[model samples]
Target: MPQIFFLSRPWDDRDVTWKFRRRPAPAEPDTLGGHVRVDSRTKNLTKRLSAGDVAVIDHEDIDRVSAEALVACQPAAVLNAAKSTSGRYPNMGPGILLDAGIPLIDDLGSQIMDLHEGDVVRVDESGAVHRGNDLIAEGEWQTDELNSAKMEEARSGISVQLSAFAHNTMSYLEREQDLILNSVGIPSVRTDFDDRQVLIVVRGYHYKDDLQSLRSYIRDYRPVLVGVDGGADAILELGMRPDVIVGDMDSVSDEALNSGAEVIVHAYRDGSAPGVKRVEELGVPYIVFPMTGTSEDAAMILADSKGAKLIVAVGTHSSLIEFLDKGREGMASTFLTRLKVGGRLIDAKGASQLYQSRISSWQLVALVLAGVLAMAAALTTTEVGQTALGLAQAWFLDIGNWFTNLFR
Candidate 1:
């Protein structure tokens, strides 16, 4: 009989340690009767498991990609590997699993990694309990029945958590925005306030590639560049400088401050978490805004507050996947902030749309006019003048035809 094992949220092994320090599951552990252990925060842990192997995962861990991958493995069962099945994040909670008809062993504690592959386990659905491969406990056992109960339990936990998060999120947004209004004394800034094209570039952990691309587009019409916290490092990597560095001031390097960009510190609603003190220690002049949101949101607020003509956002997280990936409580705040600046927000991936190298239609028209004048100048000598006039007329006709064709 195949055995069931509960596992923790698996992590991908390849993600650099700079992201999260990973401890490998022990090969010869005293716990779980020496079950294989793979521990990390990223989904890389999925590769270690073979098909039909049991996996214990947090309900919050189920995303479209990872969920499909696990389901493809055709695991006999998956244990709910979270401390609280409902409290974890990413996707709208673990509701996806309940919908998938997967069995969830809930209220499971450190027993999460106790079982190994090929061990027989029995789940009692009506009783809500698990009996190990040893099967010492007495209970009516049926796989389908237990699977249904597990799904129900998982669904209940998910629904409760999702509703709670939604309510809490809305409340947090209202409270934060109100605080921003009263304390910061600035309205949620609008993107349409400025006509000058400005591109805000962030150089944080994953932004090096995007920042380099932004560098190739730098031109005579220099746009205001804003870096969020450690994004300043990304800016320096691209051989460009940031005009403003905004964030809580924890991750930014010393060199970034002295590099000549102004600094703004994002703080909590009560003004207690002053990110500026550290900057002041470095002798960097900084302003503190006690608005409850990420520094990137604060950067946009500042840009709009100061009247940027057009704001092009680069390296900004705009999608649902990105918001979930950040794993923060302030997502609602950022969401509302964007709504306040909706029309002005252009994606960084579409940065090329703002400027083009080819001469514009207006410039082409001016070039044609200049050529006509030059032809008139050369027409002074009679023989040459007639030749020049004929050529000029032909050129003018061609130009006119091209314009007509262009509009059509």
Candidate 2:
């Protein structure tokens, strides 16, 4: 029988004087036992991951967002067939995993992909991987020192990446000139935006903070809410329903899809929409908007084309580093799209900071009641107010006596 080890707290307690003890060494290798879960796309992999799972992925230079998602699942270990950091751009994914005390095995090669899901696998102290008594693969353990060296090397190549990014941007601009020059290919949807404020939410850096800050604005203006991909879930999380959900459909959950919001599946310029399949399976009605740019760009353009008076963005990328962190190769469509939208576009942070909270009806009523009480108290305490009150009481008594005499 194979010995099973559960690493509920793999590095919690350490023996300080284990070397001082004289004992026979165990013959078996130190190992972890778990079911194998594999996916080439890190994003898709995270959705299926559970605790104690051995995540087998083929992500090269995994980005921060993907790493964060994986870490949230609390896996037993991460086995990667590709280099976690390819020295491309000081990617933060590998460093984040290692810092979280999760074991990262790198460069296990393509053969690991052959392993089926739920197959029992064990990784030994020597970084060798085994599948049911058969030695399948071996990889280098990612240590802090090795990760640091790769990050430094990646940092050195930032300039080259920037140049390539610029080239890609120019190419995209030339290809999608119509989007910048004029309003074209705006898809029709049920949600109306004519002469209304539109709030387009994207799941990006600091999105939650920005959204929270805009609570007053959202309550006041009641803007037409548009969620791009996972942003629909964000909107739902805040107890607001999205008027329209636009995305490729991979990241958005089924609950958001079934949220009774008008769904628009983003497609390539060639009219292939991958998200429609899931929507169809859910028995929900949806339409396709085939475009080349991102779902965010598509959403903004749609709002503008529908005669929106103002467009506010929450959690949208505004800086170059943000774009790089999202692993976007080019922002040409985004830049041009903003230019087309022009004066209508507003960042949520700026709007939230500028907006002043308005007093509610209950607060106004309380203020009025407090004012009346203060006036009554002042009248009772002041000499002049007391005299005036006594005279008013005398006048009332005299009127009552006159009425009684007339009746008699």
Return the TM-score for each candidate structure: 0.48, 0.73
Strongest candidate by TM-score: 2
Residue-by-residue lDDT tens digits, candidate 2, 295-398: 98889989998999999998676655455666766454676677788999997743443545699889999999999999989889999889988999999999
Q: What is the lDDT of residue 34 in candidate 2?
A: 88
**What count of clashes does model 1 give?**
13
lDDT of 1: 0.55
Give the lowest summed-lDDT range of ten residues in model 1: 13-22
> After TM-score superposition, what is the CA distance of residue 275 in candidate 2 from its true location, in Å?
2.2
Per-residue CA lDDT of candidate 1, range 1-408, in tens? 233233334322122111112233222211122122232321444555555444555434444334444444545445544432233333422333333333434445445445444454444443132434453222222243443454456544555555654665687667766544433544332223355666666532235555555665655667777778767777777778877778887667789888988777788867775677798788977776677677878877777666677677776766544454355667656666677667887767434334547888999999999998887677765797987778988999999999999999
- The parts of candidate 2 lying over 4 Å away from their true place are 1-31, 208-213, 328-332, 348-408
Top candidate on lDDT is 2
